[model samples]
Target: GATPSIDRFDPDLTIRGLLEIWRRNASLKD
Candidate 1:
């Protein structure tokens, strides 16, 4: 099922997603 566009605007989810990406990048830098 396609996720609703409104979910992208959620602050908590957005922050979590950004944190996940940042963690991945940080790990790769090590």
Candidate 2:
């Protein structure tokens, strides 16, 4: 059996975090 791993600092995670941050900021500005 293989265990899945979570990478908090992965590039994908960072990109997603930035996207979410931008989305929230954009919503606040609207």
Which is the leading candidate under TM-score? 2
lDDT, candidate 1, 1-30, per-residue tens? 346664757788888888999999999999
**Best model per lDDT:** 1
Give the Cα lDDT of each candidate.
0.83, 0.77
Worst 10 residues of 1 by lDDT: 1-10
Error of 2 at 7 (Å): 10
- Please give the lDDT score at residue 12 for candidate 1: 89
RMSD for all candidates, in order, please.
Answer: 3.2, 6.0
Question: Residue by residue across 1-30, what tens digits does model 2's lDDT show?
Answer: 222444436778878978999999999999
**lDDT of model 1, residue 19:** 100
TM-score of each prediction:
0.68, 0.69
Model 1: how far residue 4 lies from native, Å: 11
